[model samples]
Target: MAEKRTDRALDRTELIKQTTLELAQELGFTKLSIEAVAARAGVGKHTIYRRWPSKGALFLDALLPADAQALDIPNTGDIEADLRTQTYAAVDLLGRPPFGPLYQALLGEAQHDPSVAAALNERFIGPQAQRVRARLKLAQRQGQVAPELDLDLAFAILSGPLYFQFLIAQEIVTHGYIDRVFSALFAGMRPSP
Candidate 1:
């Protein structure tokens, strides 16, 4: 039946993505190749090309979770607790092996490749920024944050330091650092007495 072919195609796509990630874990992105992916996935190189345009595109698809909920910022009434939970989760994800290094490699690649940068923003970074802004808006509605606060700036304030510590300063994002950041940031953003 026609449906059988569709199911097989979906299975093959999943296999290709899985193989890509496994290879990326072993070799890292710089050494990974489409030919190796095809060979590992037991599919022709044409199959991967049909699904994605380049190595970056293929890895992007493989790296990001299919579920949007994976990146959700929770709402637990206490804005500080909620945001801290989400922030901790984000930091944990960014520090995990295979994914962490692979994602960093993608970011490095994006600096020179506009298309890759655009895709990374569209698929991952932009959504996360939107989610942070949305959570801040909710906190504002609940009187936890200043009503007049610029949420765009709030988002930057929250995420900027974390990345700077990780990627720029090359320092570990310890729990103590996160706690300190939250304490300082919340002091500035909270509603005035």
Candidate 2:
């Protein structure tokens, strides 16, 4: 039956995801290969290729837990609180295994593989950023943010430091960092009386 086939397909998909995660945990992202994933999943290489164009598309993304995907970021009444929540969530996403190393590898790989770069931009950064963008839009609507506020700059200002600390400076993003960053940006965003 079609339903049976669908169920079976879903099962295989999950199996592959779990296998990939386990393998990445054991192998780390640099040593992980698509051929290994296929072998471990007990599926043909083409099965994965059919779903994702490259290891860049499948390997890192398959292992990301659903919440870490930023698919449904909450928009609580307080935009400041929501931004803080999402910033912490983003930190959590990058700090985790598989996602962290894979992201690092992809950044290196992307220099040579344009497809990998596109996948990273499309699947990873752009999607996660939408949550923050949505929060900014809401703030604009609620008048917490100045009407003329540049949302992109606002987003970058708010998030860039956290990422810089984590990804570039390789420093800890303490809770104090979040509070200070938000308080400063919020001051800049509030409309002039």
Candidate 3:
């Protein structure tokens, strides 16, 4: 009986998370409310509050998977190949229904809201940024990149175009585009003979 209750609790938490993302996709994160999430999840508002303290916290919970890749960089002995793999993963993540718009919405919100910015930076961006930086250092050790390569600039070169297309150009982020991004950017960044 206790085990059944625990299973039910897990099911309820998942239901809340799913409904929150679904409604957030439909309604926009900024427009989504705890009341709506609770109503859709078929739970009381306190249930959500018990899990997440604020709208930002709830939405950040939903944001986790979108940014999960940031912490998981592959080391294939070939930096270029690893980057292609990672970029392709990002393309898939961004091309999905909720993530692209949700990401854009979050960025817009981050522009003015300190709490949102803090949440994104501390919980989302910082970890990934460190991971990428570490990956660049790995590339350096592997002689796949220049010993003198500016890690920050290299990362910017790798990710900046993708972000620009996603946020500014509002263009499609395809695997083909990822291919182009990897080819064009890394071609120039590869270590000199």
Candidate 4:
């Protein structure tokens, strides 16, 4: 009986989290409130407070995907092809509606809120960056890239143009842009005389 009760509680918490994310997507995080989330989740405000200490914490949890799969890079051992694949995946992630808006809001809020900034960095940015760095290191070892190339700088070189188009220019980061960038970057940074 106690086990069943615990399962029910866990289910309710999951529902609350899902509902909160939906609400946050529809209404910006700044306008979201515990009462609104509780109403959407069909739970009491106390239930939310019992689980999360602050709005930022709850919002952070909500922003996370339900399954939360890690970004996977294909290891074809062809540096340029692998990078193009990774760039496309990144553009796809950034172009999704709710996810895009939520990320933009997070970036904006992070500028003002230290706690939110830390949570965003820890949850999203750091893990993705680590994976990319590892891939870059592998490419270097394979002699597919220049030995003296900086991994961090390389990532910026590849992603910066996309970021400028999407975040600043409010333009779609198209397939053509990805191909062009990948071609240019790989050509300039290839291991050669």
Across 1-193, the per-residue lDDT of candidate 2 in tens digits comes to 9999999988887887788777877887678777998999899988887777776667655754444534456677888887787777666766776566656665666777787677666766777677677788888889888889988888789778886887678776777888899899999898788
Q: For all candidates, what are the clash counts?
A: 0, 0, 0, 0
What ranking of all candidate models by TM-score puts the best one first?
1, 4, 3, 2
In terms of TM-score, which candidate is strongest?
A: 1
Q: Provide TM-scores for the models.
A: 0.92, 0.78, 0.80, 0.87
Per-residue accuracy of model 4 over 1-193 as CA lDDT, tens digit each: 9999999999998898888788888788889889999998899999999988767777777776536776677899887887788778878887888777777766776777788778777877777778788898999898989998899998888778987888788888888989988888888888886
Residue 120 in model 3: lDDT: 87
lDDT of 1 by residue, 26-136 (tens): 998889999999999999999999998998888888887556455777888989988899888888888878767787888887887788899889888898899889888
Determine which window of 10 residues in candidate 3 has minimal summed lDDT.
63-72
lDDT of 1 at 66: 58
Score each candidate by Cα lDDT: 0.88, 0.75, 0.80, 0.82
Residue pairs with clashing backbones, model 3: none
In model 1, the Cα lDDT at residue 169 comes to: 83
CA shift of 176, model 2, Å: 1.8
Best of the candidates, lDDT: 1
